[model samples]
Every structure is written in structure tokens, then in C-alpha cells.
Target: MNLSVEKCPRCKAALEVKENPSCKAIVIKACPAGHYEKEFHPALETYIEINKVP
Candidate 1:
């Protein structure tokens, strides 16, 4: 379980992901600073799919 702090694009707040799944997409919540975390799914080799919360 790797925990990292990610920056929110909206307000630049520090976000974190506790557990990262190997074969599934994970959703990160927004911070108290009004920054929304972006969703990400890792693909084979060197590909990634990013999803944003509308």
C-alpha cells in the first residue's frame, strides 16, 4: 500500500490515495481546499486513462 500526496488541479490542495488497485480504476476525493482529485487507471506497459469528476 503506497500512499502519495497528489495535487488537485482546482485549488492545488494535497490529495492522497491509500490503496492503488492493480487492475481497476480508483477515484480520489477532493481536498478541503476546494481541489478535486482526478481519476486514473493504469494500462498495459505505459498507458493511462484519466477521468475527471464533472
Candidate 2:
């Protein structure tokens, strides 16, 4: 899988990837805005996966 970094939507701050386990397809992002979001693959009904980093 390809990994990338991105910015937070709420505060437009830089976001970093905290976790990406091989057992799971979820990715955790921590922003400088103190906001946190999870990105999941397989396109969940409510969650969206980030494709690229800025």
C-alpha cells in the first residue's frame, strides 16, 4: 500500500500518520490543530480514506 501525508480539514494544519497496522486497513491521523481522524479502506458508509499527502 502507498502511504502519504495530508493536512487537517478543520484547521488546515499539517497531519501525520500515527498508525497503519498490517493487520488492519485503518490509518490514524493527528493534526497540529489537535484534531484526530481515522481513514479506512474498502469505502465505509461513513468513513473516507485519504489518498494523498499534501
Candidate 3:
């Protein structure tokens, strides 16, 4: 993450960014009031795509 000031785009509240606890490959950045949410699968998604057989 940027480590800079992160805020919810919807309500302008502070966002909580953390790992999924059970799954390290997944990153969650969400607003506290459920205004916004996002999931990032950085390396796993790319690795899967690159290894997929055409």
C-alpha cells in the first residue's frame, strides 16, 4: 500500500487496509461503514494468468 493517507472515496472516512488473515495472497482495503471495498490479488492473479495454457 502507499502508506500515505488513505480515505474512503465514498464517505471520505478513513480506510482500513490489511491482509485477509487466512489468505495472505489477498489484500483488503475497505471503508469502515461499508461505503467502499476492494480486493487485490497482486502476485497470485498474475501467476495464474501467466501459467494458464492457451
Q: Compute each candidate's TM-score over C-alphas.
A: 0.33, 0.42, 0.58
Per residue, candidate 3 scores C-alpha lDDT tens digits across 3-27 of 6766776677776875577988777
lDDT of 1 at 39: 48
Model 3, residue 15: displacement in angstroms? 0.8
TM-score-wise, the better of 1 and 3 is: 3
Error of 1 at 3 (Å): 16
- Candidate of highest lDDT: 3
**Lowest summed lDDT window (length 10), candidate 2:** 45-54
Cα deviation of 27 in candidate 2 (Å)?
Answer: 1.7
Indicate which candidate wins on TM-score. Answer: 3
Give the local distance difference test score of model 2.
0.59
Better TM-score candidate (1, 2): 2
lDDT per model, in order?
0.51, 0.59, 0.63
Report RMSD for candidate 3.
Answer: 9.7
TM-score of 2: 0.42
Tens-digit lDDT string for candidate 1 (1-54): 335666666666676654556534654454555435444534422323243555
Candidate 3 wrong stretches, greater than 4 Å: 1-3, 44-54
Residue 31, candidate 3: C-alpha displacement in angstroms: 0.3
